[model samples]
Target chain A: MFLKNRNIWLLAPAVLLIGICFLFPVSWLLQRSVSEPVWGLQNYITIFSKTIYLGVLWNTVAIAGVTTLLCALIGFPVAYSMAHSSPWIRKVLIFSVLIPFWTSILVRSFAWLVILQRGGILNDFLAGIGLIAEPLDLVYNRFGVLLGMVQVLLPFMVFPLFSVITRIDGSYFSAATNLGATPIRAFFRVYLPLCLPGLATGAMLVFIISLGYFITPALLGGRGDIMIAQLIFERIDEFGDWPLASALAIVLLVGTGLLFVLVNALIKIRGRGI
Target chain B: MTKTTPKGGLNRRTFLKTSLCASASLAALSIGTRGAFAAVDLSGREMVFASWGGSYQAAQETAYCNPFTKATGATVIQDGPMNGSKLRTMVEGGQPIWDVVDVTDTFLAANEELFEDLDFNIVDASPLDQAYVHAKGIGCIIWSYNIAFNTDVVGENAPQSWADVFDVEKFPGKRALRDRAYPMLEIALMADGVAPEDLYPLDVDRAFAKLDTIKDHVIWYTSNSAAQQLFVDGEVGTGVLLNGRTFDVNKKGAPVDLTWNQNIRSIDYLVIPKGAPNAEVAQHFMNATVDADNQALMANTLAYAPCNPAAFAGVEESVLPWLATTPENAEKGFLIDAEYWRDNLAALTERWTEWKLT
Candidate 1:
């Protein structure tokens, strides 16, 4: 009993911290969703009834989904290569990925603005090389938002996948080779299946963070790219509508919770298959 | 949930109760400390003056705070980029940190309950424009939103009117407008041929219809910095920008020029938040700020016209045309209806969001 309870005792500080800081404030905010401006579920009803609110909700989800997929597609190869590379090469790759994490997101977003704006370096370079006659509408659009989000979030996906991949035993690949399988075949048949857990974890982390993104989307996106976080800020700052903002927050919280459950279920099913 | 308890020691319930009491007393002690300070005489007290930062705050320090501090022997500290939500939070919490805040007149009108009514004897606002001064706020500065364009990009052909801004075929480049509902609706109405005097009780449908023509061509800038960047980076050919920001950029040798034609004038007011620790000192600060000479100095420095009409008399002859309140300039611009915005901001903002998304 003592041994089993020791770990629980160790977790008590974290539990207490979360309870006081995160859970308390969030629950208070959730309570305000129903109680402010009047008592009822009217805030929720209003959210569902208005197409604009629903549209931004859908926009947030869609952007998150695409950003997750792009990050996974780009990060998997980079993380995989880093895991399999020589030690010096691996060190260089890790350093490059972690460098962006050290810089502020605001600075990076503005850097992207400079690179992607019309008559900016990218456009000027492309035009100079005779690649295109006109500067493409790149920065203040969905493309810019996705580019900035993926760049910022790629490190999140890479680190987790690298940690998991490094843990896989090297003998597995050797064993597969001995069984007359090619390197590619061995990777798909063995390494890929083993990496699923890490892939899921990284994808889930990136998706959740992207859902709450405000600054990058606001700075890089055009008129049609309003996200849920920006909408909540507008509600609070422009209208002083705390109740409605709280309600929107609650919706995001519940949606994130649902996504967590769904991802957990899928991971469990995959775990069973493995 | 149980922890190992020492023999003959306090139970969990007793421990929790004692700790709760201790924390409650700690909070009370903090509030008590603040109350003790507030009960003292106003002389030598320190007060916070909150306003939009940058050259604006620097100008205030020179024109308002410095003189007030010299006369009253009170220390004035600067804070903030004038956020409405923070003001509401501070006032509602009953421990407002800001003694005097510079906020849009519309914001003061909307959140009147959070402000203290001004006493005319304490805060002599007689030098200010009577139309802008209210019981809850004193007029601080007047600025206009004008058509600002990059001179390097547009050359000799600058946009002269809102009609030119909306006519993409004539100008043929991206334009930026403030993301907020105000002034944009007014600009749209003017572009659609509605006279300035008839703009109040805005025809929302007509404005939105006119906006649709240039909606695709328009990029939205939510802040002054963003609007400035839009022009400096050559991302937009023209944008609606605050007169002060435009002036600052032009002074910095950025190829930006402003057209005073049909600009929209906005007034910022100095208001005291309710439950301020140094409300009386803040009132004196307000009184000192509105003196004609101080107003003129601030106007000269920031390029935002002073609220005191008499300040114009002291202003440099070369600067008069640039002042938003100058007779020639004022006639070319329409005053934004603060009352209309205070009442309809929420509904209009909702529609603005919907329209932006579309």
Candidate 2:
């Protein structure tokens, strides 16, 4: 009856589009990962076994994890301010957070370079103020990579937390305090738990997106900052080794998928217990 | 895709007048040259020419494509910003959109099977140096990664060799190095006191060891544009950069300059993709690229060295010092062994990644 329902026809276009655009390509990628250079899991084996690939995979996960953590730490405060601030201040805060989305990521990365390079504006200002004798090495390091990524991804975390924080009644905080809880304890117990859904969503968004980041890290990062995406690109672009690139892609996809599922399960379990 | 012409008579008239003037000048250039492509009647024929875009490709359009178009009456539709994988895919799919493509020596060497063999009957490779000539492609330009530095930063103490670049204690600043396995390995070996000729089958371990010596002091760049930025910004006192890129920044009054000493020469070859539709016309266009005057124009514009030796005669006196193929400069550098790279690029690149992590 559900299949025969006329409303089911409304879903046809979306299903066809996803099947054509997403599923087909993913299946093709999956097929290539196993099929090319002989039919087996040799490509995956190489990726896992090789120190080069394993190192990059670790770098990718580590960078993404750090970026997600930074986003959550920074976003929590900003989202709180947006939720609690005056109407005009909220608008200004929201606008400022979303401003980065307007500009291209490449432009933003280059802007960071201009601001953070040894001879760049930030160094000149710092040196002018006699803060230090020499310009600090800022860009072209892990710091620069994380700075660039977090700037671009801040809104992703902020907006979700803002939406969730806005819905959370302030009376719950007052009630917890009235029940003889300390302000910090009340905020942590009542406020933090309420923010979990948003924090989880934001962290997942930032981490997964940051995992596939190519330009920001490539432009800003140093020698050791190579990510899995860069490796995949090199394999495809330089070597034209599609099989290996495909295997790398599948690995990233599967890893991200597993993360999504694990987080969802944890969230569901927590929801039932509460 | 057919380009839509503007639907206005006055604009069309101006366009015709401009093209006619261009054709007239091109005709005069052909007449004055010895190796200029003889006018061929290829009316109504068109072909795609692809290269790495920006000023370099613009100069190529002026040097190679314009003359070919004018001489043959064949429309040359410029395309790309060439991508290795995209080109390979097109060829493997058996319907390459590019009739002609400009690729690095390493790429051409590695993917030789993906290219159509040059039609010797159509492409007269005589005027060009035999060494630059290949069965699969024609060497369009010879450029090199030279020891480059900021004149303002390094002052009178320009780095003379890769060894000088590696000696950070002597130079005392960050140095920009190309972030690739090929020439970096060669440069490191040469820096480690290995002779240029003995550099091949690279002592990989020795190269990595040598690279480790200055790894802290180095700013590795993946692109020449980034390398130029490093030099111009004085972020690097001395390092390695392409001869042409150094010339570009120097010409722009960036106080950046390069030494031809111990330069690592590499080439860009123009090749036809395996299933290019206009293979015949692409072969004819190769003649235009080999012409002494065209090569000279390219060298004058970009400071990329001409493959045809005779082209040097027409090159500007000032431009000569910047060219990688100048007799003196050519002697100072050795061409990177692309064949060796073809076999080792993938494996060594992985090793390079591993080395960089360490």
Candidate 3:
């Protein structure tokens, strides 16, 4: 009994750190949501009732979902290649993926702005090549925002998926191949199922991070792309509406929490099926 | 892992005692140094002065902060690009950190409870423009949002008015505007031919309709620096920019030209946060900052106009036209109605968000 309970005690420091740093502040914010400016749930009501707020919330969710989907589609093949490649090639690929991580997000966003704006490098290149008569509107819109977000978030997806893919025994593929299955068949039956946990994890990480994104979208995207984070920032910075901002934040928190739970439940059901 | 026995006849307990003694002595040494440091006669008081950063803060440091520190012997710590929410949070948490903040008059007017009432005696209101001096704040800088264009792109046919900014057919390029709703609406109204004197109780519907015409050609800049960068990079042919930003870029020989026609002028104020840790020292700092010579120095450095009328005495004649507060420049531009905005900003902001999304 003593030994069994000792492991629980080992978790105390981590739990205490989280309580002091994250949970305490969050709880205070939650309390403020319902208490400030005459003390009621009016802030939440206003958020729910306002079409603009709801539109922003929907826009945030849509952008996150799309970014996650794109990351999964793009990152899976790259991560798989990295996992199966020669050691030297794998190292090069890994270094390339991580090089972006070392660059500041602001710098990356501004770089994208330079490359995509009118009369910018991309436009100059295209014009020089006689590809078009006019410069393309490649930035300050949804396309620019997506490009920036995917660039910033791609490595997040790749690293997790790569770690998981590398852990799978190489023998599983050999065994499947020996059982008269084609490479594609082996991948679908043996490899794809094995990649699920990492896929889900990478998707979840990308999605959650994208949901709270402020700078990339603000800098690159059009007015239509104003996310929840920007709205919350403006509420506090421009309007001094803390209660409303808190209420909006709580809504985002609860929504993200619900998503996490839903994803975990789906994973569990998939596990049972396997 | 097996625990290694201590060497040199020093056990764990003895080592711990020695280390503890060493740390205690180190702390005592630090305290002694701090005491010696306090001998400069500021009563060991320090105050935080919050302002927008970059060259602006650097100029303030040289023009205002250093002078204040020299005169009063009080330690002044510089902080921020002022954040309204952080100030609100600090005040709400009952541990206000910033002693004084530089903020727009609109912001100070909106968040009155976050600041302490200014005592005229302490703040020395004599040098300041009486129109800008308030119960809760003293004017720090008066600036304008004017029509600024890249001369290399626009050349001799540079946009001279807000209407030209809205006329993409004539200009034939992207135009940048601030992301905020404030001066945009005012500019839109002006572009639509509303005279300056007849501008308020603003025709919001008309402004939105006029804005719709150029919405496709518009790119929104989130900050002054971003706007300046856009101009310097030639990403936008013209933009509605703060006078200081255009001045900085032009000073750097960026071919950015400023036009004061239909410019919207506003005042930024310096105020002490409610329950600031060093409110008394903050008052002294404020008084020093508003001195005519300091204001002129700040104006010369940043090209934003000084709040003190007497500052003009110190400004060079050639630089006067560039300033927002010059009688000629001020006469050409319209004053932003802070009182009207104080009442209608929230509603307009909501509509502005919806319009942007659409």
The residue-level lDDT of candidate 3 at B235 comes to 82
Could you say which candidate leads in DockQ? 2
Residue-level lDDT tens digits of model 3 in A1-274: 6647657888789999999998998998899899988788999999999899999999999999999989999999999999999999999999988887898888898899889998789999999999989889999999999988998899989989999999999899899999999999999899888999999999999999999999999999986889999999888888878789889999999999999999999999998887
Which sequence of candidate numbers ranks them by DockQ, best first?
2, 3, 1
A1-274 per-residue lDDT for model 1 (tens digits)? 7647656778789989999998998998899999977899999999999988998999999999999999999999999899999999999999998888888988998889888888789999999999999998898889999999999899989989999998999899899999999999999888888888889989999999999999989888888898999999988886678889999999999999999999999889978887
Error of 3 at A63 (Å): 1.0
Q: Which numbered prediction scores highest in TM-score against the true structure?
A: 2
Tens digits of per-residue lDDT, candidate 2, A52-134, equal 88999999999999999999999999999999999999999999999999999878887898899999999999999999899
Model 1 per-residue lDDT at A11: 76
Tens-digit lDDT track of model 3 for B1-358: 1121222233353344345444322211111011111123463678998898888889888777775665446789999878887888798798988998988878877888889998766666765668878888888888999999999888789898888999988998789898878989989999999998999999999999999998889889886777898899888899898888888888788989899898899988889999999987887777766666567677878788987775676666667878999888898897799988988898999899999988
The worst-scoring run of ten residues by lDDT in candidate 3 chain B lies at B27-36
Which residue ranges in model 1 land beyond 4 Å of their true spot? A1-3, A170-189, B1-42
lDDT of 2 by residue, B109-202 (tens): 9999999999898888888888899899999999999999898988887889889999977899799988889789999999999999898888
TM-score of chain B of 3: 0.85
Off by over 4 Å in 2: A1-6, B1-22, B26-36
Question: List-wise, what DockQ does each model earn?
Answer: 0.46, 0.72, 0.50
